[model samples]
Target chain A: MQKMMQQVVCTVDVVLLTLQDSALKVALLKRGRAPFKDVQALPGGYIHPDTDADTRDAALRMLAQKTAIQPPYLEQLATFSGPARDPRGWSISVVYYALVPFDVIGQAGQADVTLASVDKLPRLSFDHRAIVNTAVQRLRGKSQYSSLPCYLAGEAFTLPQLQRIYEALMGEALNKVSFRRKMVEMDMLEAIAGEFSAAGAHRPAQLYRLKPELRDQLTLIARGL
Target chain B: MQKMMQQVVCTVDVVLLTLQDSALKVALLKRGRAPFKDVQALPGGYIHPDTDADTRDAALRMLAQKTAIQPPYLEQLATFSGPARDPRGWSISVVYYALVPFDVIGQAGQADVTLASVDKLPRLSFDHRAIVNTAVQRLRGKSQYSSLPCYLAGEAFTLPQLQRIYEALMGEALNKVSFRRKMVEMDMLEAIAGEFSAAGAHRPAQLYRLKPELRDQLTLIARGL
Candidate 1:
């Protein structure tokens, strides 16, 4: 019993996601050590009880260390565990998924991390493929009624740009009128006063940003888009 | 690093919830060992990687062993971990929440376990109070647009009985028309042929059961009740 009890392995993994070129992408880093060395996977590390405050702090630290990007929106996704998942004995990985704007990834100037489309992901280390799929499913599911897509849309955007973001995540074109109505019902966005999108052949559209209080939180509608 | 890695405590906790007397209640058991012995908390145990297939298996074993009740619906909630949450050492608990009918609890008839109303919970060990609150919030949130409430209603029930269960969880009186419409949109329930509620002051209503295939799955609607 003592031997088995002491064999439990604990770690935290972060699935840092972003939207790039109208497709969802995830940041991956090649493992430096064995058990899948040089293979790309989610940014993760062991929990340092001596210094880390909690699993969230450990996740944030690992993300910054590996990818050089701090996500604007982050939430606990789920935990994946078993004896067979890790080459080492029984293991538990407390997984978290974060959303960052495409520009944020670019600004990080991380040459070590690779941005891969979620749909066409390569063979990833451990059970990372499944983790990425779960995050994608959650993002798509929450996009129906929550202001989660706004994180991928960046700090400020026009109604048309936000609509395209939502449509891309949901995999379907939405009725513009109903989409706008649902957005209003969520009440999590505010017009950026005196700011508008650059004028093209058509007239400029008013810009909007998530409510200051709701930047770190999600606002959900009673119904979906 | 080796010592800290070996010191991580891994465990599984189950939040077994049921609707009793129109109120949500959680099953709790008193600890038998040190570090808060005799204090009531959620049923949990160490993950036995040698025998248990996964954390979910550990959760089910703990629930059955401690409370003698196996829930019909079980879902992973989230992982709670930190250095302070446990006195023994840095710990990781892969928490799962389960839904069972009130009659299921009665059938188990375990005197060692106590069913406490979630609204008026007593002092619990570890971070169990917060765990129960998270499970309750999840139950109430999913009840808005999924067939999750059906598990609390038992194997078969009339529409009105089901609606009452939904109202109990949501803490709101839903419009009859919209509620029924949303149920139909979910398409997860099927009427039990020739089954009806006993005639009382009001006429008997048709009895329905979650579709056989959906017994272990949830059917979701785009919009809420």
Candidate 2:
């Protein structure tokens, strides 16, 4: 069964996400070369053998180089590969999804980048639309059990804001009492001592962040909603 | 930015699993060439451009050729790639995991193949030991919410047998009533008409298979245990 090993091009693509205008948006950059030149695509690049320590490192580097974003929740979503995906030759892409809150988006000041809503997006180059769909599904599914939804609300947020982000992701309004109880059961959040948020024309709300032990860890909640 | 893309050697590795002596075990094949000759490793090979359709197809082909296994559950685990993972040169492995019942393993009659237990494994060549650990964790984690544990039990198995398989994979004893209740909530099982399994010195237990619609799909359970 000896055969010459086929050479395939490898790339890492990042689905950098942020919440803006109460909806999830993906960061896209313009292609500068042939094969769908000038089209908006996910932030991506070829794996650098000399610099990248691993695939995840390559994903992080690509996200930082393209969008100037270092999100708090970066995860390997899945790998997409096939013969006809690229015209040059057989190619494979290791896709990662990164989640960030609105403040990170504002800090980046990506005026030229296309920050399109996940639901309504323009035609993207390559298999990026499919990749985006898969990442969205993974994010929504994991938001129920893990400490994933908190990443979308930023570091210090009120319960009401976190609830709104969860509702936006799950596409359903949950009862306020039931939602609060569920959050309590998850035990992923902790009050920031006596810190509070300034809400104009509304009562100041207590600020909470993820438990210190769970900031970068993924733990399953016993009772998922 | 003008540098040429790195040329990385790509391959597919599979963690093929089946039950042996009431524990989860992975199939390993002996390597015939240098760079770790005669070392028992995961069933894997270089991607073939003229033959393999994609990473998954290459993994399937490797498992079939090495162990004679066509698993009921097969999925892409993760891409384990970097320089120094392989001794030959710059290499990347697209790792996948496959699950089959005991009957398939018995049918293969692999005298030279080694079925290593997931809990206690000998030193494996390359990064296969780490890959096996990752696959085992993923299987155990997903078994709580998906129709994954059923794949460990053969088709049309009794409830007790299925529960035993679940306990083996999860490494815990589950309450019988609670487990049954969770299975009922899943609604992914169907009783085989007029069929029963012969239990020694006891009444024949009813045989059930996954529902027709869920035989090939991974459906989420309402409550994960």
Candidate 3:
């Protein structure tokens, strides 16, 4: 029975996301060859059986090859599979979403990489549109009560900067006092003592970074704002 | 080049969970054949390419055939893969977890089924122990803010009965007043008017059921208690 069955194609797709121009953007790569020749698609590749040990590793490999960046936060989004999902054969794709810092995007992400705002996404190849949508919901839903947004703010960030990033992702203005209270309640950030920068105001704002314990992982808040 | 690659084995495993004797339990079936022959394993089987159109279908088929019960709540848990995960080459198993009511367990589940307490689980076959652990964490984590617990409470239940189920899974004594407050906040259940029953107390306990809109599906609570 094993020898007679058709092999199911396994692949990994990354919904690489970052904040660009104060908007949440997902990186898309141009296909090198057909079936979707020249079409922009999510960064993806076949999992190399010889080289990759796990699906997560395969996702990392694809991201590294395409973007040359090891994102600070990555999580398996979902597995999308069906006979009709692919043109060649029945295939399964374990989709992952990675958060990249905005400043790092210009220095890396090789040619053919294009960051498209999730709100106004171009028609993506394969079942990628559905995949991207699912990843967005996960990000937004988890962001309400998790230390996930920090991945977009980079290593050193101020409370105001962090609050801005959250606002951009959720597309809403938040009350400054209440937001600060929530950050305190989450206990996910630690103030970087003697580290302050005056961006526009005369008085400098205190810089803070994610606590080591919560870094690169999700820590659920007690409740949503 | 594609033909030269090794074929990945695809299978689906179901962590059919139920509440038994006021404790959480998961269904484990004895494997009849090798490589981990006769070992207690989650109900699983190879995904039939011809008959199964999708991974979820394969999971449901495997569960129904083995358990003789069409589970009320089913969700794709995660996809586990690797070379060493199975003795038979490279394989990927799309794991799904199902919730069944306690009363329905005796009517179905057939022979060869062993309901093991999730807290006091025995050593399972293959990478099953890890799979079970991930599933339990998901169930417990999601339980805090979702209507997921209703799947174990049967079709119609009292608020007190529902609170007891939540308390059992959470391993804590919940304050009745606060629990009712949280239940109202969730908006997933509706009181069944004129359907009060005297189970033990002389005062009748009002019957409540999952709102028609939320039956057999997880409804996210506004906040976790």
Each prediction's whole-model lDDT (CA): 0.89, 0.84, 0.85
A1-225: candidate 3 lDDT, tens digit per residue:
564235577888999999987888899988889878888899888877677888899899998988898888999888888888888677788889999898787789476788898989897789999999999999988888888888999888988889998888777898999999999998889989899977775578888988998876787778785
Q: List-wise, what DockQ does each model earn?
A: 0.71, 0.52, 0.53
Report residue B124 deviation for candidate 3 (angstroms): 1.3
**Top-down DockQ ranking:** 1, 3, 2
What level of docking quality does candidate 3 show? medium
Residue pairs in candidate 3 whose N, alpha carbon or C atoms collide under 3 angstroms: none
Model 2's TM-score against the true structure = 0.95
Candidate ordering by lDDT (highest first): 1, 3, 2
Question: How does model 1 score on DockQ?
Answer: 0.71
Expressed as tens digits, the lDDT of each residue in B48-120 for candidate 2 is 8777788999988998888878888899999988888898656689999988987888888877778888888
- TM, every model: 0.97, 0.95, 0.96
Clashing pairs in 1: none
Query: What is the RMSD, in Å, between candidate 2 and the native fold over all Cα?
Result: 2.0
With a 3 Å backbone cut-off (N, CA, C), the pairs that clash in candidate 2 are none
Write down the worst ten-residue block by lDDT for model 1 chain A.
A1-10
